[model samples]
Target: MNVHETEVRARALGLLRSGSKNADVARELSVPVGTIGYWKHLDRAKRGECPGRHDPKCPRCDGRGLDEPAYSYLLGLYLGDGHISHYSAHRVPNLMVTCGESWPGLLDECELAMRTVFPDNSVCQVRRTGCRNVKVYSKHLECLFPQHGPGKKHERAIVLEPWQQAIVDAHPWEFIRGLIHSDGCRITNWTTRLVAGERKRYEYPRYFFSNKSDDIRKLFTDALDSVGVEWTTLARGSDPFNISVARKASVALMDTHVGPKH
Candidate 1:
């Protein structure tokens, strides 16, 4: 049972000994009026009798597990184009992900992801110099996403926990969709072919995903592999590498799984 210390009990007794009202003592101590009232009822202030929540520091978040589909996709985006930060004085961590402004619909998807994880937490948006960002504040985010590291992801190692890995295994398509939507796009490639002794123009569709983090790129490729999709790295052995899935079969598979940022 949650009980109070002798200090609080003595203070409440001393204050009640004076002419101070229950509300006055509550205000002075930054506790609930009912808490002080209960203290007086018991002739002393105690914990279980108080009206405050069990976990005062974080009453809203259990800081426990994660949502399946939402977290898988959100993790993909975090690996692709997200960052986490926290302020001083026992502040909760904030997960901030940015995307190009042209795709306003992505904001809704991101908001859904945040709400999926932190149903009671707040999600906000802001427009930067050239991009848009969706931010969520919660104390449990770091617990779910332990990859929360400093500096660019490319400059550090990005790995997944077992539970997160299981989510990706079950929801590989959603993870790939999120990665492609954030750091990649669908494009129609054009080429010229001879038709009946005449030069004819033909078009084919392909998907491209690019990122600076090698580990993140590997994670994307691994998700694709899980779905039996083929990808090739372009301009290999270079900074800011690119991955393209252009084979007719691979393109068809990707088209079925991932689409334009809507």
Candidate 2:
């Protein structure tokens, strides 16, 4: 682990031992509660209390690329709305991705993605105030999600290494699906038109993604461009901007590849 991770893990553990709730600790640290929970599991495993999903001799952690389908899909989610925390107190990485509680389907998809990425680990979901949290414990996760760092994604650079770029180039659609499912959404846009002599409601579907980081926005659009998915920039007078694909064929293509998150 690094110095920042070491400091955060220490703070989390200390705060927890001092009668602080996991949520409170997370709030104080600007991290997800699942992150503190991962530290808790690590504290147990270190004392021979819990058998964690950790193996020092695992080949996946032998400094090789983990270019897999699950990782590709997860990359999109991470860039969109996921957060990966590397704690020195834990033996592996803790990844937390949440969606609104109202969208159980999205929550289910996030859980499924986590399970697929870490089949040997148990994915846990915690009910928060307005969102559902999905946490996964796996050592190999850090390899695939090297973007794990401090502050918000928009506040710093979000560049991918050469290895990660190669994986994304190989699975562009999966990346797009994850991004759309997380930060973007599919919706129907209706407009009144003259079908007969009077008027008719024409409904069309579209996919949109909004992010503050220019790098993230570029990454998302580049992935779409690679897949021949045409999208346009939507005007928004804010820091984080939105881009969308509303053409008929493009929507169908996204539907076939990504579909609705639920």
TM-score of each: 0.73, 0.74
lDDT of 2 by residue, 100-163 (tens): 8888877767777776766666466766789877777766566667777889998999999897
Per-residue alpha-carbon lDDT of model 1 for 1-262, expressed as tens digits? 2356567756866897687886688787776444555456445214232211122223124545557888788888888888887755224467889977778778778878876876666465655767767876666666777898777788999888887788899999989988987788999999999999999999999899988888889999999998999888898665558999989999998878777787
Whole-model lDDT, model 1: 0.75
Model 2 ranges with Cα > 4 A deviation: 1-47, 50-53, 56-60, 63-67, 86-93, 195-197, 238-240
Clashing pairs in 2: none
- The clash count of every prediction, one per candidate, is 0, 0
